[model samples]
Structures are given as C-alpha cells and as structure tokens.
Target: MATEKSGTVGKALGLLTLLGDYPEGATAGQIADAVGYPFSTAYRLLNTLVETGFAGYDRREKRYRLGLRIYQLGQKVAHHRGFEGAAVPILQRLTDLTGESSILAVLDDDRFLTVHKVDGPQFRTTTDPGDRGPLHTSALGKVLLACTDPATREHLLETIELTPRTEHSITDRAELRRQIDQVRRRGWAGQQEENDIGMAAVAVPVLSASDRLVAAVALAAPIFRADQEALQAHLPDLRRAAATLALELPLRA
Candidate 1:
C-alpha cells in the first residue's frame, strides 16, 4: 500500500522536488512545515531519501539538499525533452517571423514549466527556460488551462491559490473562469500587463494527433513594441509553429 502512487513513495518524491526549492538546504523541521507534514514523517522521508542518494545532508549544518542522483535523473530528462533537435528551431522560426520571444511551456502538476525559449532582441527577463510560471497570469498558463481536460482545469482552478503577481493579475475567481472560457472559445489566449507591467503575451496550444493538449507556444514582447492586436495578428505564425511542434515533440500525455 505504501508503494501506491498516492502513498509515501509519492510524498517522498514530492519532498525531493520541494528540496530543490531550497538551494541552500533545509532542516527536517523546515521541510515539514513547508508541506504541512508531521516532524516524524518528514524525518523518516529525509533519511530514506538520503539513503537512496536522492538527497544530501550536511552533518555540520544538519540541512538537506538535492543529491547527485537528482542531477543524473534531471540530465536524462533533459535529453528526453529533445529540445535541441525539436523545439528550438520551431521557437526560433516563430521569433524570426514575429520579432518577439517565443516560449514553449508544458503543464507540470499545478505549475506551468517553461521548457524552451527563443529570446528576441531586448527580450530577457524573469521568464527563463527553467522558470515555473504562475497559472493565473501567464499566457502559457491560460492556454494550457483552456486546452486541458475539464476535470484537471477545474481542479486547478479550485485548488491553486491565485496569488496576484501584479495589480493586473486576475485574482477574482469568477472573472478568471470567464476569461479562461473566452480563451477556449477563441482557440488562443492573450494578456496585457497581467503578470508584469509593460509586458504583453499571446499563446496557442499544441494539441496532439488525438487532440489532447500537449504543450503551448507563446509569443511575448514589450507592450510598446506590439500591442494585443499586433500579437494576435501573428496567431497564424504561432499556430503553424505549434502544429509543427505537435508532430515533432514527443508527448507523454
């Protein structure tokens, strides 16, 4: 039973992911408090992780950090993502056409993971390739939510805390749901100054051959350079790129 997907094994993996957030390492108590786990359970999981080489403990500081094994597995995952061979060229082409940065993102649990990007001139900020973007404010997040299965999207909307990144973020639940529906109807998503001031974005989904939403590709630029209409005008280009990625990129979902 403990080996079940919802059991301690799963929690331990989640704990391992949480440890990555604390680059400086964390105590068992700190980790427990962060995930609301009991002290005894957290200590046991930490020890098990250490024994399995999934985590490292500094005896002097008594803090735990991600171990070498995680790096090994992460390298393998990066290899499987196949970005260099597949996604990069597509994103680059989209940027070349639109004169804006192109981002490729996937839905990972409750977060939107930025897996690849092609940055245009004067386009570099918080949205790096490895960053985890907020669901309520990002064009990538909105498109993923709109295109995902109804059950998952509903669960995300209910469980995820819509903490506003900026004053323009959609903190109101009803309004956010309405906007998500609009994104669904329009077959693409767009935002202006929702996540960050002076930034605007639009995204289209990369649906699989079976019509499942696999990933999202977005074009982002400064509002001064391209307003909402200008970004939407490039939807033809973005959707073409997304269609190409849908065929090229491997989909686990």
Candidate 2:
C-alpha cells in the first residue's frame, strides 16, 4: 500500500521504483491500482514527476516511463547499472593493489548495500554485488555512518540494532559510537572478524568534488591471508582508489 511517512516525496519516488518494473511503461490508472492509491492522486503525482523530468508521459500510449534525468542520476550510482561499467575496473585495480577483495557500497535505507565487488585472485568472498550488510559491523558500513551528517548518523545509531555477526562484533551502541568517532577522526574505518569470522576489512569514504559523501570502498580478506596490520597497511591504496572514484562517481551536489 502507499505510505504516508514521507508524504508526497516518498510516494512519488516509490512510483519511480515501481515504474522501473514496467519497461514498456504503465498508465496512471495501472500505477494507481498497483500502489493502492486513488487514480486522481496517482495521476497528479505522476504528472508532477513528469514535469520534474524524473518520469515521462507517453502521449500516444497514455503511459508513464522513467525519464532521462533518472538515467543521468542513475549513471552515477553502481546499483543502477549505468555506472557499473565505470566502477568495475576501479574496484578491480583496488583488489590488485591490496591483494584482497574490493567492495563498493552505497547507503540503502539504514544498511550498507554492496553495489560492486571485485574478488582478488587468491580468495573469494561470499558477499556479492547486491548483498546488504549490517551498518555496525562492516568497514564499508562504518565509513558510511561516520561520514554522513550528524543527524542521520545519530538516527541510524539510535535505531539500528547492534546485531553481532560474530564474537568480534560490537553489539553495544556506546562502543560502536566510539568506533565511529575514531573512524570520523582518522578518515577511515576497519573491522576484524566482525561481519564474518576470519574475515577483516578496511574502508574509506568516496566523496564528491564538493566533499559530500557519495559512497564507500573497502578491501576485504580472510584474517589468515591478511591480518589487521596487513589490512591497515593498504589504507594508502584504498584512499587513493576512493579519491580517484570520487571524481568518477559524478554524484549530484
């Protein structure tokens, strides 16, 4: 059912996501029924989205489809597939530089969404491109939380359960905050056997030219293959890759 939480903005974007399902496009009435909204409400919101260029109306077919603006913005985020072509090689190079798996993640709701991943020649991880990971346990998640604005960070910390994936995971919110604080200060984050036993990771935020947090990249490997010191040693390479990706992501300011 359509929700009231985000009011019009949320519903409108929800419509866009729903629209993605119909590549041939959908009529306003079809969209309204799918979302459980009144025809008039759906039509108005769809028109609004069309006017803003986030959606398009097919006059001949009397249908709505995703617009060019959506494609332009989608080309900057990995999961959108438009930017994956550019992101894949960068991740591959990072994996080569560190001799570990490289991960590219973006915020998905309150979790870290794995959008792109490159496995090292020596080892492979169970996590894949569409995996969603805990925000409190993985290095990618920490960098995302640490770099976000204070309000969002606090909201996530307060609301997200500190679910321990392994014995090393920080289940305590206070301790997690301290770790996040350290990550904020150091401009990077690390996790040891937190998300997975015998696995470790280190990450840095991919910031836009304007210094806005666009995404995060991480190098992950098993502890036997790369211990904490080994992981931290790759920080320089990770930062360099992130810096380079910042220019490539092309996020909206």
Best by TM-score: 2
Q: Per-residue CA lDDT of candidate 1, range 43-98, in tens?
A: 99999998886888888799998875664456457746753646899888888888
Candidate 2 weakest lDDT stretch, 10 residues: 75-84
TM-score to true structure, per model: 0.70, 0.72
TM-score, candidate 2, is 0.72
Once superposed on the true structure, which residue ranges of model 1 sit more than 4 Å away at CA? 1-85
lDDT of 1: 0.85
Against the reference, the lDDT scores of all candidates come to 0.85, 0.85
Superposed Cα deviation of residue 118, candidate 2 (Å) = 0.5
The digit string of per-residue lDDT tens for model 2 on 1-42 reads 355646888889889999999888999999999999999999
- Model 2's number of clashes is 0
